[model samples]
Every structure is written in C-alpha cells, then in structure tokens.
Target: MSEATHSFEESFDWVVVGSGAGSFASALVMRAAGHSVLILEKTAFAGGTTAKSGGVMWIPANPFMLAEGEDDTLEKAETYLDALQELDGGAAPGTSRIKRRAYLENGPRAVDFLVAQGVALRRGPDFWPDYYDELPGGCKTSRTVVAEPFDTRQLGEMRKRLRKGFAEFNVLLGDAARMGHMRTNPDAKKMLLRVALRTVRDKLLGRSFTTAGAALQGRMFKAALEKGVEIRFDSAVTELVRGRDETGAERVTGVRVEGARGSGTVGARLGVLVNAGGFGKDQAMRDRYMPGTRAEWSLVPEGDTGDLHREMERIGAQLAQMDQMVGFQTTIAPGTENDYVLPGAQSLTGKPHAILVDQSGQRYMNEGGSYELYCETMLRRNESVPAIPSWAIFDRQFVEKYKVADKFIDKKIPKGWLEAGYLHKADTIEGLAASIGVEPAALGASVARWNGFVHAGHDADFARGERRYDGCHFVGDPYADDPARGTIEKGPFYAVPVVPGDVSTYGGAVTDEWARVLRPDGSVIAGLYATGTSTASVMGNVYAGAGSSIGPSLTFGFIAARHGAGLGNLA
Candidate 1:
C-alpha cells in the first residue's frame, strides 16, 4: 500500500527494516505469531531489487519436490555445497558452516511455512537444472520454486506504488521470456498456445498478472498487510539506537530514521531486522571493495545504498565475505532518461552461433556456461589478460532465430544503438574484429576452432554443450545437426562489448544460524538480525540453485522471527 510516513511511538514489539523478501518474511512471520510489527522502507516504493528479479528460490528438498516425486535430500544438499566449497572455494574469507547448514535445513521449511500462510508459490519447471548440474549434490531437474503470477490490480491503488521493473526486464514474463520466439516459430505451437491461454485468463478475470519479480514481491506485500503489519515508507533508518535492556544488558533497542519532516526514533521491543538491499549504486563502496564492478553496470534498486552496513558497522557487526557478489555480463542500450535495455546472461551468450572472446581474441571460457561461472573465469583472466569488456561474436543467422531476452531485436539494429557503437556491424569476422579492436587472425582462428568443435558435436576446450544445463535453455535450430553447437559461418558479424558485470551484491555483516548479527569474536549482538543483502549470505559465493540468495534470505528471516517471538527453532 501507499503508506504515508508518519511519526510513530517510541516502541513496537518488533521493527523490520527494508521491505524485500527477507524483511517482509520476518515481519509477517512475527505478526502471524501475534506481534505488533513495524516495517521501515527507505524508499517510497516497495519490492527493492527483488521486484525486478525472477522470483524463484533454490529449495534443496522442498515439499514441492517431494510432492512431485523428485528425490532431494538435505544430505545431498550438503554434499552439493561441499562440492562448491571444494571446487570453486565457495566459502567466503571467514565463512560459517553452521549458517550454511542452517540455510539448507530451513530454506525449504521456510518456503513451506510461507506457502501455508498464503504465498502462492509452486515448483518451477521440473526440467530446470541447477547452474552446476554435474556437481555431487546437484539435481538434474532443479528444485527451485517460483512465485505464481499475481495480479497487481488486487492491490488497487498500491499498484502505482511499486518500483518500476527494469526496462530491460519489465515485460510480462520478464526474466528470459521468449514471447517473440513462440509467436513466430512454428515448432513452438504448444508454448504459444499456453501463453495465449494465460493472457486470455488474465483478461477474463479483469486483472493483469505480474510474473517473475512482481509476483513474488506482490504476494509478500499482501501477506504483510493481511496480518496487520504496519509498513512505513520513505522512512530511511540512519542509525541503530543502542540502549540498556531492563536486565542492564546493552542491546539494540531501535533505530534512528530521517522522516519526511524530521529525524525520529522507532523502538523495537524484541529486535530490529535489517534485510535491506545491497550497495549497488554506492560508488564509494564499489570503488573501495569491488573496484572492478562498475556502478553503471549494477542492476540493484535505486534505494540500495548500504544503510544497514553503515549503521551496523557502528555496532561492531563483523562484515566478511565482501569479495563475493552476484553479476553477469551484459551489453546495455539507452532506453528512457535513466533506464536502459539489455540482454540477460543466458539469453544470447548461451545460444548457438556465439563465441565470447577476450581482447586477445581467445575464448576464455565456455560461452554457454552459467553467467556466474563464466564471469568468474573472466575475473581471473582480467589479472593477466584484457578480459574486461569482452566481446560476443555472432552472425545474422542467430539474430534472425532469436533475440536476447527480447531486448536486442532482429533483422535490423536500432539506429541509436548503431550510431552509439553499442552494436558493431561488419560483413566479415576480420572486419568485425578490427572494428571492435581485436586481432583479426585470432578471431578467425577462434571461430574456426568453434566450428570444428561443433562439427565433432563436442567442445574439447571448455565442454560447452556437454551438460544438461547447456542444452536446457537452447532454442533448437531445425537445420543444425547439433542444436547447441552451430558454426558462425553466416556473414554480417556483430559484436557487443561485455564487462565483468555483477547483477547484485552478496556478503554483508556476518550472522549466525539464528540470523543474529555476530561480532568478530563470534558473539551475538543481542536483539539484532540481518538477512537478504544486509548480511553476509549463507551460501557465500555459490549460487547453489536458481533461488540460492532468496532461499537463505527468507529462511534466515524465518529463523530470526521465530527465535525473537519466543518460539524455539522454526527450522
């Protein structure tokens, strides 16, 4: 709802800061157990970065999996995490095994609880593979679950209050939507019919269903309101107010927020939850910690400026795992004044007839690999090679068959993009390489090797299409012998410059299994909990499943709420 920021009394039973998934989940869980909850959002709008995201959670062995006869176990999940920690050093600089275990144990349980309390979530595509499907604990058919479509019209006037989705991903199916494909591709008749049916159903009901990010955030907003939690927007918390408890223990009592008119304090009887978003636009922080990550490339919500970090740092919350973050390579084009359009990681890079090359015109990593994995490769390559601003070389044939998440178009390029040099066009690979400032011979050799690999139906260098995950998202080519591997022989080559991009920030103040912020000495800062991007993520750098970040975010939020409400161990 469009809640007005008003003066509040000195006390509430519990104060939740930020309105993202973790914050809302904690607030609603506390309210469900009969606590007067106050949610403070810095921005006028709700949803944060999550509303623009694909609202899915990586539930290791969620109830949905069991009900659908998919076998997943907590033990298997641990094995999978162990593989990540061993293979890729998924563990952060100062990681906690306890919290990681907590995430696995309670992630599904938290989703189950929220579902029972009326969040319309269902198992996502059963064929969806984990980003690392070959790992020990990885399931071939992923256990990720997404929020079902929600009609924002149900919120009435609040529909206007939501933060606008990213122009790059603001469409109906937002994340990786292939609407334009099914509409024209004769082979996609069944999918096209399904889309048409859904559109009709939505119209018949006199409601426009919001998918992906909107669906998830809308449900959380509705659930919070249904349980009578008071949400105050435009109330930016500036400091954590510390005071002595009745027992003379110095603890976090409340927060100091700059209100619309003036600054005031909102007290919390139990504890304060800081589930606020990351510091994506915080140029200072980016310069200090993640120097390589450009502020312009970050896709976080406008309101995220690391308020929780600033306030919690004063209280001595140990902030580790800062090195780990979320990102993918993207090529952006201008949209409205501040908004921009771009392609997603899997949308174009994973498609056939594409080979990403560094400045030396060498394929650094598998082009069809997960964005996270490939970018990690690029980051390591940046130290010795010019991996920053890599290029994706493609022919007109690929563009004809598919667009990048429907952001990049087909047949012809926009005049603005071409003029701005965002989309480089050349008739030959040598011309394309020279246009983009790369060695012509190296580019030619890379494409030649790529064609050889495709002819063999196996990538000997990086194993691009060997796994199910690679083939899973492929837009099949009718003429190609191997759909995942196609020769980039068609003329009119194109190149889009890509940077080592991170989409979201991970790692914040360290927290325990109970979601309570911790000290350098591993003691709890009593009455203070943080989740989502506000605290160091439980999974460290690993994107365990599709919903890794959100799953731990919500589960930790549940753990905090239950513990604070005097109910023991919701996990």
Candidate 2:
C-alpha cells in the first residue's frame, strides 16, 4: 500500500539508491544538471565495491585514449565488441543491441563528464594492456583510468564515513607510492629502500594506510557534496513505489526506505535510480543466478546484496542475459579476511615458478594466462571435479623473486601465517602433497613435468606463459626468457588454496541502451532505471579490457540520468 504521500523524507527531483561508482556518478550528473537529487546508501558508510577496488574505469576509445594518441575509434571498438558477442554465443539475450551501442558511443563522454564534475581520475599506466589485448580491436595503450589520491582530511567529520577498501590495502600503502616513482626515476633502488623503511616504521607504529580506491571515493563524495547532492547512510530502499497518471500509465515516483530513524516514503519527481551493486553476498540469489559461485570468495562489499534487483523485479522487471558465472580466482591465505585476499594477484599467479593444479594434483591450464582465462579454466574444470579449492604449488625460488598475495616477500613467509595454516610448507613436493591431502606421487610427477616444460620454454600440455597477454596483462618483462614459466625445482614447496572468486556478479536487473529497466516483453519501465552490476553487464560474457565493469557503470548511469531529466535521448 502506498503511504498517501503525507509522511515522507524531503522530496527530490531524483532519488538515487546505492553509492557505487555508477550510483554516485548518477547522483553527481543529476545534481550538476540542476536537479534535486538524493543519494541513499544502505550501509552506514558510502563507497561500495568500486571504492574497494582498483578504482579503474575501462573506457574503450575514451577521451583518455584519444588524448594519448591511441588509434581507437567508435567503428573499431564496435568491431571488437562484435567479437565479444561471438564469445557470449550471441548478442546478450534480453538486452537490446542499442544498449551496447550506447555504451560504446558515450563511454568517452561519461569519463569526460565525470572528470569535469571533479572526479580525480588519471589514465592508467602505459604498461598496462587490455585483459584480452590480442583479441581483435584491442588497443595496446592505457584505456583503464585510475584515481589520484584523495585527501581524507578534506572529509573532516565525514572522514571515517567511507567503506574500508580491500582490507585497506588499496587505501593504506605509504610505500606503494614508491612503485610509481621507481617506474620513472633512475635511482629506483634508493627510492624503493626509502619507501620500505618508511613502510616498516609506519607498520611498527600502527599507522593506518590510506590511498587508492578510498581516496577516489572520498574525492567523488566531496564532488557530490560540492555540487549540492545530499547523501543519507543506513537508509535501505525496501521497495520501489509507483504511481499512475490520468492516462493510467504506471511510473515509479518514489521509494519505501527503512532506517534507524524510521520507515518513510521518499518521493522523486524526475526518476528513481536503483544502482545498488550485484548479488555478491546474497547466497540465495547466488544459488539461483550463479550456481557453484561462492559468496565468501567475492571481493564486493557486504552491502552488495542485490536489493535493487529484488525490489525492481517485484514491479515486473525482467532478467537480462546474466551468465552470472564464476568471475576470477586468486590465491588467498587461510586466515585473512575475505576482503583482504590479494587484490588482482594476477601477477602472483601468472609469475614463473608456480603451477595451479586440481585437488588430484593435475595441471589443467596455462599458469601464465590472464585472470579471466585462469578462472574460466577453473570453473570449467569444476564442472568435473572440485576445482574450487585447487592449489597453487610454488617453490622457495618463487617466493624469493616475487610477493605472493600480501603474505610473503623476499623469500620470507610471515610466522603468523604459518601458525594459522595459511601456508602449507614441505621439504619435498611429495611431502607438500601429503600435507595438503593430495596424491603424493601425482604432485611429484606434475612438478617434474612442469620442470620439463619450463626448461623447454614451451608447455607441452597447457602452454603456460605462451600468450601475448600473459604476466598480468603484459606488465613485467614480456620478453623474459619465460615471463610466467620457471622451474619449480627448489625445495621447501608451498601451497596456497585457490577458489572461484569474483569482484561482483555480472548479472542483475535488465535495462536498455538508455539504462531503463525492461519488462519481460521488452518494454521500458517508465521512471525506473538500473546501472552497474545492478543490470546485466553490456559486454556480455567476456572481460573486455580492464575497467570493463565500471566503464559501463559510468556510461549507462550518465545515459539514464540524462534521459530521465528530459534531455533528448541521444542513444
């Protein structure tokens, strides 16, 4: 029953639900256009998955790419997209073709718009390549953009109002600033030692690390407030309230939200935006939409419970083509918080000296492949056996050369981790297998075969390190004798369990090119819109480039807000 419009929160021209990049960007655009916009976050603090992420927005042929003199164009991007649809089996099931077109056409515009609105984004590193760079239409330069650090001091009383980022690694990294400098400066060793000493000192003093995603969210929050956008936390929108016009046409007018204060209806005149994140933490929905996916392994915030899709579905929303499959996997320590599991440890997995094997001690894929391909292989293997808890077997040599997740560096494993069973160490490969409960002979033989492949620089069985996009999207020494292939001959082997993990669910409420939620019959639901993971990702099944997730989020959120505000539909 509708609350007779008598008791309500202060009405706004537009009510935005959720505070992810898409939702926050929508609120910013709406308010910038002079609309009365309200931002509601279910969690006590703002910044959803985006704030906990790399804060990179993938925009193909974006303004950033254009400014960099990269030869990217709308037609070329479409050609690339065509290949993606082929990967998804066809055009995404319920979504219109125009939706994909809209994303391609306006992705640059959205980035430019957000930059103009005070988002502190900079082009991602030049060394970074598309996740699937070898695929047709992939550009070789920076397309994903990262945010410059935002000063939390500016938030003042609102300083602690942001959600913690990836165990605060994305935020807290006093020494991480040195990596950027080391890349460009000649005295790299000196700079690295300087940051290392400071990092050690800060850790000893228990100083908090603050940077990256949190900074971006802080800046975005600051921008929203500067533009007069009002945000209320701990307010969960329970239902989308609709009203009828004289012609009997149904349209969403407001939302029914419950909070610490009390339950109340909040009216919106321009439109109601449901940009809450996907069903990462919603187990019931996960089983229904993404069977075999684990909630405990997801990187999304706890508040990403698919609430927006649930409410919108009750009002006749349809499901778009959400393959909603296993996203990606990374090695995680046993006792670490789920949020703290090595952000984009793609480098860790793809580096030489390691091999991923199933529980039975069998190698199933190229260890040096992209994160998307690695998890895709893991999921495909899970179809036969339990690949969810497969092991990444590596030797002491690997640890000495590279950091594994956040656990070990420079050949040293933290004593606490060993005590907590995070690291399974053994003097011999067979012994390591026994500790992890796998076949001893099988593990030993697999390591022997991997050594043969490494010596040959060609994986006879799985072809590890053979791809152009290997080594975390071509970041480190693409020309190394074996970028991701190394002999696992050294003793004192270790095993870190791998799982089928994801940043967010790919599927959610169905929407059109203009970001309007669609009915089962494919009609646009007037006055209702969806963006980000709350809707089916426009890219279909494949991970395009980096930032593929947020690129669509920003673009469609902008498209939806613009269309809802009576700006003529440009799509």
Candidate 3:
C-alpha cells in the first residue's frame, strides 16, 4: 500500500510508464493531441521486452492487409476472435465481447494513426498465416504488420540507449523467417547471402542497423522524440498517488518515481497510464499465479520485475488471467544458463524428423501449431506424466538437414553441449533411450510409429504438420514434398530437453475497452489506464496470431491515449 502524495515535483498532462510497444504508441497519441506527455522508462533502454521480441503486430483487417487485396473485415476478425473463446471453455473478462469489439474497431484506426504519423510499417510475409488459420474466419494469408529495418545511426547519441533485439542479424522479419530454409531452398540461400552482405557493408560504413523488434522500437523512439514526447529513462514508478474524487471514488493522480535523480512525485493532470510490463522476472509472482513455472525460463528484461503491477494492485486495480504467458518453447544450449534470451526450440520440435516425447517415451499432443499451446500442454501434461522438461528426439538426418538452436548443424556435435549434458546422442535407438532414461522399447516404438507416419504422409496418432503454421518454411523443410514429415532412422540419434519458456508473462491489471483500469466491481478507476502486458491480455489466454501480444498492447495504448486526451477513440 502507498500513501497518496499531496504534492509533486513535476507534472505532465499524461504520464506513461514502461517503454514497451504500448508506451510509445500512447505517448505519440498524447503528443499529437497537443498534450504534454512523459514516458517513464524503468530501464536505460527505450523499448522494453518488445524490443527483444519478434516485433510483429497481428492486427486483423489492418490497412496493410486490405491494401494488399487480402479478404478480411472486422466482422471476420470478430468471428475469428469469437471462435477462439470457446477454447477457453468460457468468456474471459479480460477479453469480453465489448473488449473484443473495441479491439477490432480500433485496431485498424491505430495502425492508420501510426501511418499518418510516418511510421514505416508493412505487412508481414505473404504465407504467414494465423496461428490457427484452420479455424473459422481465420485468414490463410498474413494479418501481421512489422516495422521496416531501421538504421539506428539515425538516433544519433540515443542509438546506444535503444535496446538490441534477440536476433543478431539485420534481416527483415520475412527474410529471417525464411533463413531456416537456407540449406534447402535457393531463394532462402540468396536471402541469407543478401543479409550477410548488407551486414558487412553496414559494418564497413560504420552504420549501425537492427531488425525485428529493435527496428520497430527504434522507429517509435525516433518518432516519439520528434513529436517532443519527453522520455525519462531509469525512472521507475514505485507507487501510484491516488486521490478521492467528488464521487468519493479513488482516482490515480500521479506516481512516486525512483530514478537517477532520486525519489519524487510526478503528477499527471489527465491520467497515469501504466504499460510497465508483466511479472516475468518475479519468482514469487510466478509461484502465486503460474505455479510450477520458473522465472529463469522467462526472457523478459531485468526491469520487468512487476514494480507497477504491485503499485496498481495496491491501488485496487483488478488483475485477471495472471497464470497466462506468451510461451516461446526453448532448449537449454551450452552457455545459455541464466541468460535472458535462450534459443527457442519451436522450430526444432516442429521440423521434420523430430518429435517431442514424455518420460515414458510416448508422444502426447500435436507438437506443432502455436508455441503457447505446445508449452501449456507441456505444463498440463506434467500433472499426470513426467513432462515438465520433455525430450525432443531426432536423428542424424535431422541434424544434417536442419538447424539446431538456430545454428547450422554439422556432422560432429558441439563438444561443449554434449559434455555439459545439454545434448545427448547415441548410435542406436535403444542406446539413445538408455541415455535419456526412457524404456528402449517404448522409445523405439514411438520412433517406428512416427516413421510410419512419414512414409504414409499422414500422422494418425498426432498430426505433426497438419496446421498451415506447422508446415511453414521456418517450422518445416521447404524443399521436402511434405515439408513437415521425415523419417528419423539414420545412424546416430540426438536428444535435447525442451522446457516451456516464454518471452513475457501475459496477464496483469484488468482494463476496459477504453483501456482504463477497472476495479473488481467493474467500476473504472478514473484517471488510471493500462495496456500491454501490464493489463490482462486482450486475446484472453490463447495467442491469436504471430503478434497477438504486441498488437493488442499497441492498439489499447492508442485507445487509452485518445480517451485520456479527450479525443475519444479516433472517431
């Protein structure tokens, strides 16, 4: 609990917290509406966990999709979103019918506003289907929007302050997705070469460049700075300053901040928006919400320690769906211990010649489709089966054909990975089973069954590559006749422990369609707003598409700023 500070050292029309996707978008809206907006970033960097992410925003019926002649509409998107709700078994308050309508109606407008503001955005890959494109109203083509590659050199001295992304290469999201097919596809090889050449040329010219999330944030940071949105980095909001309104209801008036200058109260004349991210780094919060999940498996930055989440809780903000996370399945490679960014194994497990199995050496669920579903299944399966850390079993053919940990695999295994027990290898199926502590016959049976599927070109037990997302070039081999099916009967077999990892926690304070924070009784906490992972996700518990997390974050933030600035939902 925090005492309401009566006085303040500084005041702005709108005070935004956390420099993730939502922060910049809302601040831009505030500035455009001629209000004094201040973005308070807890970390030195401009972008929060978003900068380390894929940076794709899944906005159905977006302008870019429509402009490309893709058949999509808000009604279609509504059906798609509605169809996914049944998967949760009930209506989620966070993603209520009104909230869903709000997102669909305003999402395109938000993108339009960004475009009108000169943010260079484009549609994602042509084949980048919705995670559940097979579902009703789901488009087979992409509904994603991503920022173009940005040259950070344009940021001047602030370039150093912008956070780098998870990917080291300066490749577009589409090109990066195709990079997995470099070995098998000629076009993919050319794309890789082009990116490599661009990297070398940029290096020689002393020009710094970044792609994906970094690129998006870099552009947003530039736009925000240009719009005169004052951003104070290292300024953490430790408490929310509340005041009673004429109606006897508590309203957030300001924030108690701890930063480089020291502790002080910063008041907001309009309202305070807390887009300060989720509690991915807090073990206690994880235990309380998502039990049995370790904070170490999270890829959120150090600053995502739930400072504002606690503050919002203290101020009586309703927190919903606290157990959900944007799961990005990962494998522990050598030197990856304790690192914020671990190599994701979503591609590995979905690729041909590979299958995930439990301790008893039996395949359970479909190893493809959404990574969120895959990891959630892993955690749920652990209740009855020993599958917290499942084994991804493959053969030498897979190693030679595809990438392992996003690196090209050669004939010889990495010695450090093998020595540190991060990777296990054996000559025969029985030997591999013995090494991984599973019954040899069981392991052999699973492999033989999977091989039969590969030969028959259909998975009867668990359809591996059934989904459009599963058969994508990145998840499966591009050259193979059936991209997602291949036999695992080569000389030496390999295995790695795959854990349910995440980019960020997905749940937090509950907010309305206006992006205003709400109390348990469904009353709005006037003068308080939230978006991004700071609020319970708009998609409820399921990941809608490639950029489900970032898309809703950015859209709701846009809505919040408009409401706070008295603009009212961009007309």
TM-score for every candidate vs. truth? 0.92, 0.89, 0.97
Cα lDDT, all candidates: 0.76, 0.74, 0.86
- Cα RMSD (angstroms) for every candidate in the order listed: 4.0, 4.0, 2.1
Quote the lDDT for 296 in model 2.
Answer: 79
**What lDDT would candidate 3 get against the real structure?**
0.86
**lDDT-best of 1 and 2:** 1
Q: Can you tell me which runs of candidate 1 are displaced by over 4 Å?
A: 1-9, 165-180, 183-201, 334-337, 404-410, 474-483
Name the regions of candidate 3 deviating beyond 4 angstroms: 1-5, 204-206, 245-249, 338-340
Count clashes in each candidate, considering only residues at least 3 apart in sequence or on different chains. Answer: 4, 4, 0
Residues 151-246 of candidate 3: C-alpha lDDT, one tens digit per residue = 899899888889988775667777777776766777877887788899999899987788889988999999999999999988888888887655
Best candidate, TM-score: 3
So what's the TM-score on candidate 3?
0.97
For residue 505, give model 1's deviation from the true position in Å.
Answer: 0.6
Candidate 2 lands at a TM-score of 0.89
- Writing each residue's lDDT as its tens digit, candidate 2 over 88-207 gives 678775344677788888888877888898786777766556656666886656577767756565676777888766534333232343343342334556856765676576667654
Candidate 2: where is the Cα deviation over 4 Å? 1-9, 94-96, 166-189, 193-210, 321-328, 338-345, 409-412, 416-422, 460-463, 473-481, 569-571
Better of 2 and 3 by TM-score: 3
What ranking emerges by lDDT with the best candidate at the front?
Answer: 3, 1, 2
